[model samples]
Target: MPQKRRYKSRRTNYRRKSNKNNRTTIILIAIVAVFVVSFFGYRRYVQYQSESKVEMVQQDHSQFIKKVSPYAVELGRQYGVLPSITIAQAILESDWGTSSLASQYNNYFGIKGEDPSNTKVLQTKEYTNGQWITINGRFRVYSDFRESMKDHTKLLVDGTTWNSQQYRQVIQSKNYIDAAVALQTDGYATDPGYTNKIIRVIQKYNLKKYDEGIK
Candidate 1:
């Protein structure tokens, strides 16, 4: 009878150990599964945030283009300037109408002026001596973006005070490419890559289509 009782106790002890091991295995598997799920969830969240940012940026750019295209097309047709060139210049110089000059004073073309009452002194970067330098510049202020666009078109048509025929090539160009190169040759901007930058903006946004209403 004593031997039987001892055998029974040993079997019970073995079963308890087996059950403890199984419980431990289940706990470890559950932990691993939780970790994998959390990692993938976090990855998906990050991806969603990145896509949202891209979509917002694209929407902002589209809005800017829509707001400016009508004025550009109208002014281009009246003044014989390519709307693509005008719109591209506005986008590049004003950073999609977000720059201080564009947002506050409505100066989209960065036109400098000397009038004390009609000009705002602002810091501007110039590509000079093969390097970019920040300098104080007096820029003309306008009542609205439409006025700014009108002034810019007039500048191209009437030219600067020193030379009345400075931007003649820009108005006479047959296509966006020629107009972009003419702007550089006509000294509209000092940056060495100004022509290429203008061309890239026009191409990226398909700004040439705005010129369809004109000749």
Candidate 2:
């Protein structure tokens, strides 16, 4: 009888040890799972923050366009032109009015000439002999920003190359992208990606809202 009692006690001890081992293994597995999930969650959160910072920088760039957009709209209304297109073109040409030429000469559009009778001489950088050569080139200088806008409208309307039906249709579409693309296709600019850049600036700044008030 004593041997049997001893045997029964030993079996109970063994069972308790086995259950404790199983519990320990389960706890360890749960801990590992939680760690993995937290690691991935942290990684995703960091990625989101990085993306948000990039978007904020882009928004800051767009703010400049927004500041000067109302002037473009008013000019368009008076000249019977597309407001969004004018604003996008101005943003593209002037670099949000931060360019040296724009700041000094009020030349939002880089219209150049050499004849004294038809041009205004300004100190500007000209690409000559594969170098950025500074010279006093004849550029169309405006008295103010409003005059620049008016001259841009007049240039578009009177210039035979830009006065085509196709160009007019695209501008009148009231779509900023369409107008920008048309400008590039119609030889309005020499840059290959000029239209895409203009479209990006317009869209990023939400400049299309100016078209809404058009009758």
Candidate 3:
């Protein structure tokens, strides 16, 4: 009888240990599952935030284009310049009107000024002698973006002081490609890739549509 009772006690203890081990395994599995789910949830949230920011930036760019397109087209009609080129130049020079020079001084074209009162001295980057250089320059200030656009159109039409016909090729070119090339050949910007860059911008944004039916 004593031996049977001892055997029965041992059997009961073994079953208790087995039950405890099974419960511990289940808890561990639950913890691991929760961790995996939380990690993926966090990643999804981050991805969503990134996408939202990209969408906002795209919207801002579209709005900037809409605001400037009409004025650019009107000026192009009046001055015989390509509206597409003008808008592309503004997009590149002003960074969609977000640059400090554009936002503060309303200078979309980075035109220099001789008069101190009508200019703001700022640091600028220039490509010189096969390298980029930083230099301080007095940039022209304008009352508004309209004035800046008008001034830029006039500059292209009238040309610079040293050469009265500097941008003649640009104004006379029949297409945006030739115009872009002319801007580079005519020394509008010091960047070696200015022509290609302008062409790429025009193509990417379908700026040539603005030039439709305009001679």
| Candidate lDDT (C-alpha), each | 0.93, 0.74, 0.92
Best by lDDT: 1
lDDT of 3: 0.92
Q: Put the candidates in lDDT order, highest first.
A: 1, 3, 2
Q: Which ten residues in a row have the lowest lDDT in candidate 2?
A: 160-169
Tens digits of lDDT, candidate 1, 1-215 = 99999999999999999999999999999999999999999999999999999999999999989998988888877888888988899899899999999999999999999999999999999999999999999999999999999999999999999999999999898899999999999999999999999999999988888988586
CA RMSD, predictions in order: 2.4, 8.3, 1.8
* TM-score per candidate, chains pooled: 0.88, 0.58, 0.92
* Per-residue C-alpha lDDT of model 2 across residues 2-96, encoded as one tens digit per residue: 99999999999999999999999999999999999999999999999999998987786668566667777777677667777788777778877
Order the candidate numbers by TM-score, best to worst.
Answer: 3, 1, 2
Query: Tens digit of lDDT per residue, candidate 3, span 16-129?
Result: 999999999999999999999999999999999999999999899889889888998998888889998898899988988999999999999899989999999999999999
Q: Please give me the total number of clashing residue pairs in predicted model 3.
A: 0
